[model samples]
Target chain A: MKLSKLAMVTVAAAMVGGTPALADLVFPSLSYRTGPYAAGGIPFADGYADYFTLLNERDGGINGVEARVLECETGYNTQKGVECYESTKGEGSLLYQPLSTGITYQLIPKATADGIPVHSMGYGRTSAANGKIFSHVFNYPGTYWDAASIIVNHILDENGGDVKGKKIALVYHNSAYGKEPIRTLEELAKKHGYELTLIPVDHPGQEQKSQWLQIRRERPDYVLMWGWGVMNQVAIKEAANIRFPMENFIGVWWSASENDVLPAGEGANGYKAVTFHGVGSDFPVFDDIKKHVVDTGKAAGAGDQIGTVLYNRGLYAAMLAAEAARTAQALHNTKDLTPAQMRDGMEALKIDAARLEELGLPGFGPEINVSCENHGGPGLGAIQQWNASDGTWTLINDFGPADRAVIDPLIMEDSLAFAKENNIPERCN
Target chain B: MSPDFLNFIETVLNGLMTGVMYSLVALGFVLIFKASGIFNFAQGVMALFAALTLVGLQTGQVPFAHLINAVLGTDVHHWGPGLPTVLAILVTMLVMIALAFLIEKVVLKHLVNQEPIILFMATIGLAYFLEGTGDLMWGADVKALDVGLPSGGSFWWEDVTRNWAPAGSDYFGMYIDTLDVSAAIIAVVLVVALTLFSQYTATGRALRAVADDHQAALSVGISLRSIWVIVWSIAGFVALVAGIMWGAKSGVQFSLSLIALKALPVLILGGFTSIPGAIVGGLIIGVGEKLAEAYVGPLVGGAVENWFAYMVALAFLLFRPQGLYGEKIIERI
Candidate 1:
């Protein structure tokens, strides 16, 4: 009987040991590397994956527990992205970066209910920057409204800070992502006394001749492009043909990329755009990539593309995800964490320059702090101009403070109304 | 009152230019409908694929040297100026021809004598298949198509005297986009050439003969198979030109297929079989919608342009069941 009891205990121990360890943290990467948006998606995915790999290699895991990133390709479709979220949410996913506005909209309600964080970064419902109703959704740096204000300000400054009686046309992609900035522009136009003409370009933005022809006839003083993929290049070429001063044109960040301008070559010279983050080889994280990721033979892109616009965006996104996990680990005694712990960790996280420097990203812009009331902590960015001759982008202005005074109250008022409508629970403050 | 009337006239004129572009695509539909009763839904995708291929060749994504070396067993590392453009166009044309041939051989050959509706559904399947294949081949980056077309306007309209006078007002003046005007001119030329060929040429006549009575034409010793190939080839060439013009205007992306859908209302407005009707219908829809959006759209809270073309076509359909130039039916059943 003693021998039998001992054998039974051994069997029970073996079964317990064989059972898979519950993952400390689960992060789902909603990637789109194979679809219409793949040109932008592929590099972003590569950078995201490399950063996670770097953390694993250098940190020996976040706080002694390894970090796991589960990737699901969504092909940039919202339905597919939501399906991926449902399939992976059960795995204790700490956060989701859908990288798509449509997907973010669909996931917002579910994410709030499930208490999982959704980090949209530069894209998604701009109104969700309100930390109240969209408590789960975080659009850090700035929202589309912030981007529009900056672009309009830059144009005003270029035209001597008086845009009254000027005609400004917006040739935008017809999607939620493109339409996000229109309301802000209209408000700004009303305040500033400028004429705003809205032209909606259907998806994939091929066939803009008629639109450009209208520009030629109407001769708007300034043209703001909210385009993506080939739409950017097409607009540039069309503007160039019509002899529209390239200097008078501004593109949203998504519309401004090396791929967009490089194809146009000399034609896209003097085009300007607003950037939420620093560009090119200026950031300190690039050095870390060279030493840790590239030197280790794990970097996923060509060596030259390490600090390109989209690549840096992907790097920044990964940094945010890793920092959230690190913050979570700091709170919990054990490094191994659950999604709830990560959520709590993200809410309390503070990422300043000193923190960035210590983390080997000294050149990364000012710190971002997340709280119950402010999901977009660093609502600041500078404008960059593309010089076709040098094949480079240069910072033209520092982050101007004028936009904030206008944007803050709007964010608060909108967030409050949204909270009321969505039945969002009041914050503890 | 004068300024208001001038603005009204300007908006109408602007709408006409828009209509011309819509007509170009619609004409492709009419051409295919004339030769084979099937509405080629893949026409828009064909335009996108052709344009992307042209741009890709110019940029040397997959070097022309490599393509030529692989094909001709040459060691050439560099090619001559504009050679890539020419070769890419040739290759695209050949691909389109092969596509037309394959479409006939694989799909249409099986559905011979089937209802027009069935053939239309098949073309829709072909549309999805072509879109996927085009994406696979070109990797879905929007590409700028440079078909050696000029895009700027001339100094004649910009002169001070021309600018000041009411008749010479920038609004009233013929300050046409050289590229769009070229596209319009090319479209007109193609339509004329097609019309003449159909009337004067033997093979064209044989194709028309086949269109008129397939069984009777077959009995008269004209091979339906050969005639089908000829008509599809002509349609394929016309599609290539349409693709080039539209692709140059917009970057060649998958969304070009939707522009092909704009041809549907054009087909409905113009009789499905009337070439002239397609042109007229396309022009009407294009110009009409833009004018509506510019003036009437503000009254309706904007976005009226999106549904205006369909509404106009629907209204026409309700009044004239046979279409503007469609054949009058004489039912035997």
Candidate 2:
């Protein structure tokens, strides 16, 4: 009877074109590998899949339970993202990493209702970091608000702790992701005594003649950007064209990829961006990925994306999820885990300096400690500058702290408002 | 000059340059519409594909490397050293010409004598197919197009204009991109070349005959299929030039296709049947939108440029449906 059941299971799996077995841990990657933003999305998806492949190959499927990445293309469309989520959530999907902020916003409430944890990483609704209100969503390691605060702190450090009467301009993509830092920056402006200018770039951001011309006319002391995909590249080129001092212009983490800078050639030199993790292929984990995944012909997409900025971010996200799963396994003492179990694992997860060192990434990222109340980790980040000649990004500072004094109240206000509107009861006791 | 006046002058100059860029894409649309009367929605995608092909050839990247690797489990990215920029461009032009032939034979040929809307739908389908095929041929990474085009601000112009302002004024200098200037020059050259060809060449006369009336031209010795292939090939070459300029400016990527939308207002303003109309319309829309965004956007929360062109087009549509230079429409009672 057992032999016949095994045969029947194998046949069923074969009939499905060799889909992952139902028993494996499922991580659905809602990726956009086509459309305007595909330049950024392709590497990220490759990195996400390759990291999971590494876990399965090198570690024998995360402590004897295999992991499967079910990727669905969203083309960066929010509607398609929801469809991908709905389609893949039934495959025992433990977590979701919807890279697009728009898709993450759409998936937050639905994934919450479905009891699936979403890890938005560096991008998403800022208030989702307040785990008390957003129970199933986590934007750990850093949030947009945290990045905003961190950038302000860096600027303050550069200016000898004073920016009174200084004009600081923000050139942002006119979307939810771009609008995220406005409130925080306004608050920071009130505290620091700097004049604020807001410039919104529409989707795709291919043309910015008027905005850059305005920048030239106004001549602000510094510029901050919240852009993604083609917007980043175009903005950098335009900034270079207007002779905007490259060092004075900084981008959010999403805007700091190789794809963004490489298009500008030497013009992108000295461009700075906030980063939560280390860049390049100097990390030891890439060695194992090469041995087990790329060389073995099990890599995702093209193998050329192993060391890119977004790729590293995707790998970092997968690393966090795997660590959380291992933590859940230890807590429950079981190899087979459910979605709820995965949520519990993510909540109780902690990665310290020692743990990072052991994971073959000694200084790859900040120490993440997720909890019931604080889902956004320590909110730490650093600055990375582009060296156009060598085609490399050098981290300019160590992981510094975000201004929690200003950030916490705003988070509280936003989370409480969200809780009241959604009628969600605060969870963590 | 007053600082405010200098700023206005700067804005206008930049707008004109931006308009020239829009006109480059609009010319392709005008060519197809003038000849075939099919609103080729795929013009933007054609530019994107042409640019992608140029970059792929320049970098010597193996076509369909991803698909091949997936199916055969083989790692093959590049065959050998890349071709020179000029050689790659020539090869890309040939590829685009071949693509034009294939499109005429496979898509446009079957839809002959069909309604304009049907042909338009076919072009839409062709656009999507071409976009997908381009992605498969060249990986979707953003590749920098280096045709040795000098970009950044014109320092000489800036230095000359810096002293135009009063001694105490905060205005540093007028900002103008050298690449935009190059694009303007190239666009003028393209327009002149197109005009000379249409006026002097036999094929160009044949093209003009078809544009006058497709059925009438078919009644004569003109082969409508051959005219389409030729016009499309010319449009394809125009797309290659536009793609190179744009791809150089913003890097060759998918958003290059969205530029076709920017040309829509130009088409509406400049009658779609006139090449010079496209250029003039592009300039009007470009300057009008830039000035609107600069002077009025701040008062109304900014980002008005994205919609300002459409508003101008809408006004033109309501007042003069045929546009500034479009052939006057006369309907029989």
Give the number of the best model, judged by DockQ.
2
lDDT of 2 by residue, A1-429 (tens): 999999999898798885444378889999989999898898889988999999899888988788999999999999999999999999999999988888998999899999999999998889888999999999999999999989999999999999999999999999888999999999999999999999998877888988888888888999999998788999999998887899999999999999999998888999999999998999889999999999888888768888889899989999999999999989898877888999999999999989998888889999889999999899999999999999999999999999999999999999999999989899988
Best by lDDT: 2
Q: Write the per-residue lDDT of candidate 1 for residues B223-248, one digit (tens) a residue.
A: 87777777677767777787787766
Model 2 is docked with a DockQ of 0.82
Model 2 residue A353 distance off true place after TM-score fit, in angstroms: 1.2
lDDT of each: 0.75, 0.92
Instruction: Report the C-alpha lDDT of model 2 over B131-223, residue by residue, as the tens digit.
Output: 999999898899999888889989999999999999987868888899999999999999999999999999999999999988888898899
Candidate 1, superposed: residue stretches over 4 Å from native = A1-26, A33-38, A53-75, A156-179, A186-220, A228-234, A259-265, A281-308, A355-364, A400-402, B1-14, B63-82, B113-118, B160-174, B329-333
Which candidate comes out best when scored by TM-score? Answer: 2
TM-scores of chain A, one for each prediction: 0.90, 0.95
TM of chain B, each: 0.86, 0.98
CAPRI band of model 1?
acceptable
